[model samples]
Target chain A: MSDKKTITFPVEATHVMMFRRSIGDYAVPDTGLEKAAVPPTFPRAVAQFDPDYHLRLKPGEAWFGSGKKPSGVEGKPSSAGGLHAEQHFEFLRPMVPGDVLSVTEHVGKTWEKESKRAGKLVFTERVQEFRDQKGELVCISRGVSVRTERPVDQK
Target chain B: MRLKASQISVGDTFEDILVEDLKRTQLVMYSGTSGDYNPLHTDDIYCREAAGYPGVFAHGMLTMGMTGRVVTDRFGAENVKKYGVRFTNQVWPGDDLKGKAVVDAIRQENGETLIDMTITTTNQKGDVVLSGYATARAEK
Candidate 1:
């Protein structure tokens, strides 16, 4: 736990523009947004800057997404990468598109539960902190992920 | 618009229609932006043939992200000190969503006024897809 991995996220205006469009926030125009703040959920885009983010497809690595088959990687379990359970963000200051953030994530907590439909559910929590170049804390994001024993029963 | 403590009261509420008939393309767009390319959110074939489900569903983050507009619009993104949500149900394409924030309390913290509110996003069926709370600094 001592050697925590940190990713360098250089916030770009184009990335913020695309993120705003993706979230369908038209009112908060990206134009001149460098002087303003991004969406409250803007910190979630740090995944794009994490080189080892497992959810994204990496070159030379087999992805779980379908190509010729239902899954490109063999024996990939259903409900791959787990499901997002909860997310919480605390911002000391708004994230600006022009700020370079030093992001670090570490495991927080783990627990297990039993569900009739999904069977055993293992929940893992991760905490990510975004710090500006000045090393000042900008934001803290906490996300919980649940891994189901099987696909959730669509009842 | 900034939330003013003097102009607001507990039990007051504000809301917005987050999306009408949520589209799969939006999910793809989110993945493109957020770097979450999990097939469960964008790959229908993977959802049907590989994973046992109806089809591709929207990412929970997408719902959270979309629902966030209401908060930022009301509180101003800079004023939002804390925002959080729990995914209650799966969001599917064509599902319409509405987000609401109810004023739970207004109090003084650190000599500054703050607003605590409850956040909820519901689908067309009245099913809550996301529920949580938010705290924002309010203008006194």
Candidate 2:
């Protein structure tokens, strides 16, 4: 494939069963981050590996390619460390509070597509495996992401 | 009573789950968040006139996610060992969807209880939309 890249990101134990429940101790509503109806799961997903939040989007931020602006993945490997496509979370086991989790990711596939405005849309497929503290496979999330030329506003 | 595969006969039927009047907005919101921009879901005109569907349809993931909700709510998250399914039919918008899970078989090994469950989603007319199975651990 012309101009293709691949990448992977790991999900953490603490993040596997994490959710901003509409009701609960960890309840986090949509506060200027996302539409009120779209509860953000980023906190739970990213907290597993990146604690410091370095280079990771905060809650309510978009994953994959930002429709309006450049996602800022330049000169970096397609994996972009933790960049993901659509994460398919297969809940083999339910993770509860205080249950630790860990995830390992690998870029399984990569390809490229031609888009009218974005020129060449480079896509990467990432597969992430989640495990509990005991190292039991808990979930598998597959994601697809597209990369393209930076928009004028972003560049 | 503890829910186990042995307790549930293979022909035994589980409770029927129904979601009434799925809104078009629900499908739209799911599309926006899930990044599945398939015209079959959001484009009403395409769904009705072009695709021959009654209207826009719901994402299979939304229905699957709801099933996950049922499993988590029934057995609690910790008891779930693994959950997966393959979509077999399209769930159109505004159709009352019903879900039924049956006990396919039960097996225990080394103190671990594995209950094989078969899940089916059907339209209000009783037309099957999706069907699959789930494996869960029994609590000791």
Candidate 3:
């Protein structure tokens, strides 16, 4: 089954400024970018508008298991502990303010592994592709989240 | 800053970046901006009592984002073709992270110049927190 969904949002300058400031890129030369161009890695801000944005907000939920209800997993706690294992990005074009991005995300991979501390670890990969208003590919992002069988405290 | 394709060699190096110290306010702003509100990153009480962490830590993406500046500052953002990273260690508040990107190879493919690079970010203790590679098109 394909767990695919599409999200659309305009790149806002205010959010871009906030992201730049948050990362401490304050010395960016004022090349009149307050109106158009955005900082590098700005496309990642799209997560703010995801409908399931709340899924990643909780600390108790496993980073991999967040978003899906605990009922989805059998013989395990509703929320487990996990980590953000990896991230990859491919940028095809520069993203600027006012450009509306249509992002589509779907499950990419699922696997298991044996670990000394966490016991067995389950990993889930999600890939998000962003296209411009003209349907031209702009960026591709892949995120890997791994969930453990037991909590950190239990380990 | 733009560099000609011919000017970049296997040993070429981009300017190193001294990242600002990780701060609590920066973590909160990142959570709000990136929508990654994991309590281990933003809430101190939850980190201590529930997560059993020393304290709130910066998001991995935040460190990645800061490390990326080394590339965008030298090659321009639009030039980036691929970037990937492996999280090696945690970044704590007050830690001063330093990032360096070195050219690993320069190849010509399909009439386009491609520059490959290896990136590493280390904290004040000289411990590597993140390491990865990136590929970008050269302006020349």
Candidate 4:
């Protein structure tokens, strides 16, 4: 299984504003962000533009009850129930509307451990690197997803 | 809006900012905007009946994003170099949250001054829903 994928898209002011509003930053005067400057965590919002950006595993099957389904890969675990365990970001440069960002994502470390509640827990980390139209690095994001078996009652 | 590394002491802390109460409508808005249609976040019935959650809850990203404002509002967003968080607790509807960012350390690296900060967000019940750390370039 190829452990990497890439996608590119343009940033839109409207979408950035929607994200601002979604987080209840209603008082941020539109004029203050005239440059289309996005918030610190805005890169995550832009990632949704990728067509393949969906949880790979089903909620009921993963241990934490949620997880990203690995794409174009076989032999991946199918069990469900997981949670978004952790998130990390490195913003190397600012992003603005009209800028096209090329994002490359690759699976990082994957391992398993024993947990009392879920029995065996599987953890996966995915890293995404974002570059701008000028080919300058913009941001790097890491997301950790953990999968575990659901309790018998929840199943 | 850049903060001078020398001007900010290691113990300096930003005043707590109250985030808007968590609302179902806001969760739905985030679901639509982020394109994360996880039934656990938007469908109460599915969350309660299928996922075993008491009810639909706000996305952890939503809480992180809101808490991030504490940093960006004090220091420019462009100055932020690193930000991260761990989801410690679920935020339910009607829960009011407050966030505060404290300067943990200030140091010079690669000829640039940087400030390290620890961020914490708590619900009205005083439960720490989310906690994280951040690093940003400081001016002066």
> Which is the leading candidate under DockQ?
1
Q: Which stretches of candidate 2 lie over 4 Å from their true place?
A: A1-93, A96-128, A131-137, A141-155, B1-10, B32-40, B43-55
Q: What's the distance in Å from true for residue B9, model 2?
A: 4.5
Count of residue pairs whose backbone atoms collide, per candidate = 0, 12, 0, 15
Q: Candidate 3: list runs displaced more than 4 Å.
A: A29-40, A55-81, A149-155
Error of 3 at B42 (Å): 1.0
Compute DockQ for each candidate against the true complex: 0.85, 0.09, 0.47, 0.43
lDDT of 4 at A145: 77
Q: Summarize candidate 2's per-residue lDDT along A1-155 as a digit string, tens digits.
A: 11232122333232232232311112223343322221112212433243333333446754333333323233433223221223344555554444445655567788876756435657777566656767787566665655554310111
Model 1 interface CAPRI class: high
TM-score winner among the candidates? Answer: 1
Report residue B101 deviation for candidate 3 (angstroms): 1.2
Q: After superposing candidate 4 on the true structure, give the runs of residues whose Cα lies further than 4 Å from its correct spot.
A: A31-33, A55-81, A114-119, A151-155, B1-6
Candidate 1 vs candidate 4: which has greater TM-score?
1
Q: Residue by residue across B22-114, what tens digits does model 1's lDDT show?
A: 888999999999888889999999999998889999989999988888878777777889999999999999999999999999999889788
Candidate 2 CAPRI grade: incorrect
Best by lDDT: 1
Q: Which scores better on TM-score, 1 or 3?
A: 1
Rank by TM-score, highest first.
1, 3, 4, 2
- Candidate 4 lDDT, tens digit per residue, B1-140? 44666678988888555565667999989877776666667766556555556777888888888888888766667778899998777788989999888998888888988889998999888888888999988877
Candidate 2 structure quality by residue, lDDT tens digits, B8-104:
4555556545567777776665544443445555666544443334555666666665554444444444565555555545566677876777767
